[model samples]
Target: MSETKQSGSPELQWVRILDLDELPEGRVQTVTAGTTSLAITHYQGKYTALDNRCPHQGGPLGEGSIENGWLRCPWHGWDFCPHTGKPPGGYDDGVPTFPVETREDGIYVGLEAKPPRIRTVSDVMVETMTQWGVTHVFGMVGHSNLGFADAMREAERAGKLTFIGIRHEGAAAFAASAYAKLTGRPAACFAIAGPGATNLLTGLWDAKVDRAPILALTGQVDTQVLGPGAFQEVDLATAFNGVAEWSQTVLPSSRHAELMSLALKNAMIKRDVAHLILPNEVQEMPAEGKPATTPEGRVTPMEITPPAASVEAMLKLLRTSKRPVIVVGHGARFHMAPIVQLAEQLNAPVVTTFKAKGQISDHHPLGCGVLGRSGTPIASWFMNESDLLLVFGASFSNHTGITPKKPIIQVDYDAMALGKFHKVAVPVWGEIGITANLIRNELGAIDTVDQRPEVRARWAIWREEKLRREKDDRGRGINSASVFAAMNRVIPENAVIAVDVGNNTYSFGRYFECTRQSVLMSGYLGSIGFGYPAAIGAHCAAPDRPTICVSGDGGFGQYLGELTTAVKYGMNITHVLLNNNELGKISKEQRADELEVWQTSLHNPSFARYAENCGALGVEVTEKARLDECLERALAHEGPALVEVRADALLV
Candidate 1:
């Protein structure tokens, strides 16, 4: 410890920043004291401290050499006296100086006491976000976004928000999207101007298409250089036009709090992406004591009831049909309780689209697992045999194979989503929960046949088939069936599982049986690299819930750096990685199309070892016998964990 030397008033804080001999003769080194940057210079056997920023163009004098007895500004060659911070021409624009003393143990520099913190525009905007219930933010800090980043830092310190600094901005966006998808609330993703801003597009698109609420905060170049093609300048508003439900640039004269309130309101209300662009200068502008906006009177309860006539029409089909089947999608995630109750009232079998895998537990008496490509035969059989198809909160995507031939009753809150693809017998425009309850209350005694026995029979058949598949091994690697079977036995019932796109996800949908787990995915966009980052988001959104990620080698390889991110935050996530040593799904598609399977094979490092290197528990499962044990160990590990399964490419 260095002895303190107070050179000025009692407010001067003497902080020992460098050890003795840390600086040699005629050298300058940069140091920091309570957010203030200082350049310590040693000349003529004396030590001195000066403001690190050069008077000209705010360049760093500490990064320059003491050439010809003057500390030069590396950016523009502007020079100042090494010891006194004065220009040779006696110019008035000289750098400021601070008191420095060589003490017994080290060098001590005296800094003026930090002033009381003042709120900036970023604070007002960020406060509005928190008031709107944004609890988490993921992003990378860069030069342009420093002001906003500092505001988030303060918010984090205050425990009002949690900020996760991710490895890549794309991962940040994916994490935010998954956070929203799992929580039904918006989480913010931040990025700097130009490339950083553009990197968030793919994940934002995933949120946009899947109807997940997400807020994107992007930094921009100075407003003066916005249109002049300055460095790292892009027309962000135009760039985000398609993805964002609402996009605006924060201007000096804008109502900052109102802007943030509107951004978050639009995101939640529309269930889509909202963007705010912060210019470098405007983000640091004085707030002038403007109060942040809250969601007190801004948002309304969204339990919209269907029209009586529409409800009657839906009941007409339900009453007449003997075999009714209920299909759900990612949109029905929040209203499954009422939907499941209505399904039970009508004795209808409930099947989910791939994106809605865990909306209803596969073990439910009426549950028929996922439908379409990544689905069980039971779901397909039930859907095909049903006379009436009652789909709630589903878009009828072609991938889901929701046939239009059947008498369909589609329920959705968004009017545009009702009968979006083709015509339906009855289109109910209301909140899914309210509409479902209304239907159940009105339909007193329906003559619909009990589908529970048939659902049970179908599940038995599917499980038997899965068991048979699990037993078949061609000596290549572990099969996906056994992998998911182990996961079914090990993962927590209420865990949040983020699945990536590939054969592994296909197997997860086909084989994994859920109790009450929440599933997250890039539903419409079908993007890769979503799993691990999404697990990060899920853990952040609900830290109490166990988080799991299911990914193939190809998908996991995309954002492998995020493994380190999970370890850095000590996020408890069990990642089940299916290492087929290939892009198994694409290879299957290639063969189905009668084309050559080229560039589908992958060469990967041992992901288990990689996880260990990243400071997390790593377990490798090469045989089916060890699947359960490795999965159990990985799930039981305290921090982030990875269970890499070497699996047969064709077994999926």
Candidate 2:
């Protein structure tokens, strides 16, 4: 490590090292100044520096990985700001960050004290956020959180952070969720008490399900009026218990930075949302101590230790079973090499859950596509015939593999997920340990049952046959199959696809063949309105790649306001609305259940017109002949665009 800056000013004295070109993208390099160490990262042609230690347990920051603008500590995946050394959400204390100056020859870091002012609680709140790397806040304003909302406005004007207002609390939560997922950090959201908190539940659940970090701040009644059945005074602590990883009520006139710090640390450490119930009185409180700075040092990486006996048992079982099958999930995604090696070692067919669709390419000889109700017939057949099943890194949700009479070996990071929905004969927990054990230990080789060679060949033939059939399945008029094929042709190979829940989702699953895996869906949650915001998130995550959202008219209407968010961020996602003039899935389900389908039918708006109103390029395709042109136009547009494809009311 080298130092460059030499100054006598205690606040401004710092040092510089390596030229800007030396820092690699998505990787952080450590530099030292006196006894202080810092992690420096370069993103989108900008250099940012933070104390090398995490405030939560002093994890090493240099070891953390950089994705988007957030730096995730490698040890426990705690996210922090490389710009101001502030943790996501609000933290009581932030890392000590120095001013960064870049020149043609080298980069310099300077330590400087901020000018003091008579700051309000809201002022401190915004100031704390400036230390963190967040540039925007996605939320809905209400009476309870009005002060915080006003503070956000001030922050926006001061060039500290931007505030994006949403239509509903649910939408705000969902938008924040998407933002966090895209940026790989905890995005903040504000909601009022009572109904506001309740409305945010669904989106919060979605975030928890997807493992996205978010910060939810809701206003509460003053502490002095507690248990008095005061208006809007619900037990916020109990109300948000199950919805968030950590929830707490801020006391009246309490130290704002300290409480905010606690919330941020909890969210970062737990890798989940931290809900802070701020009382009206607390929003105007004054600070007591000098605001804390970001910590310094390297984060320790997590290690998974394997159980020796369990590994040996699993290998022995794999060797004994002639027709074994491996089901890969998201856990397998993190260790792609190990998974590929295991698949090759056993010569077993590999099938993925919907979320893990492209863990291994479908073109691989032993690779089978998704396995579920929407999976390919060949994958279903493989599952039905397998003698031993090895499932990795995914919960055996009800929507996944239904059930197999054969023995199951489940490998996952969460023990609760094991044997929750299905029975598991051998369950191994932890990512690295299970994988390492399998690789190191070799059991006896069992005789290969070559009886299914012809069967396997037939399945391969069938896969190709299905693709051809899909291509030729376009009917006389506009239909789901034709729309999918058109979309497949128009979307770039690297595009990320977000499919909304409904009958349209089923059609998308059947028709869309993702060339490379960047597709996202609600998966087990099956939540409505997931498509649009998720597409925005995907675009944020990989701005270089285009993102397309396929949704039904009903699903699109739920979060249509997100168009403003896309425009604000200058994202270039293409929104495709499958206009069928009805809730297609619910209509089918009602008919099946012999119930009256009253509200299932919908009179949808002209999505093209709606998109235009939101300041994005819009196109309407009522006929199949115009789809290719419309899709092309929508995709080529500079910013967000919408393409509405009108189709029949029913799929049959």
lDDT of 1 by residue, 1-652 (tens): 1112348668888899888888899998888887899888898888888899886677888898899998888889988888788888767778878888788989988887787778999999989899899999999999899899999999999999999999999999999999999889999999999999999999999999999999999999999878979989989999999999999999999999999999999999999999999999998998867999999987899989999899888887788999999999888888999999999999999999999988988889999989999898999999999999999889899999999889999999899998888999999999988888888889999888998998889888888999999898899998888888888888899899999999999889889999999999889899989998899999999899999999999999999999999999989999999998899999999999999999998999999999989999999888889988888888888999999999999998
Best by TM-score: 1
Worst 10 residues of 2 by lDDT: 292-301
Off by over 4 Å in 1: 1-6
lDDT tens digits by residue: candidate 2, 1-652: 1122334556685466777678876678888765568888776667777778777666788878887777888878877666656667785456666567787778887765445544467666656655555565667788778777777877788887767666677777776776665554677777888788777777778777766677888887667877878878888888788878888777654566666666666665455788888887677675545473331231234446447777777777777788877787754555666776666666678787776665676556677767785566767778888898888876676567646578888877666777887567888766644464465345434565542463467566765765565444234336776787788677788777778888788776655655565667776567899888777656755678888898998998898888887887788989888887888889888988999887887877788988899899989887877889999999899999999888665642
Give lDDT: candidate 2, residue 224. 80
TM-score per candidate: 0.97, 0.72
* Alpha-carbon lDDT, every model: 0.91, 0.72
Candidate 1 — worst ten consecutive residues by lDDT sum? 1-10
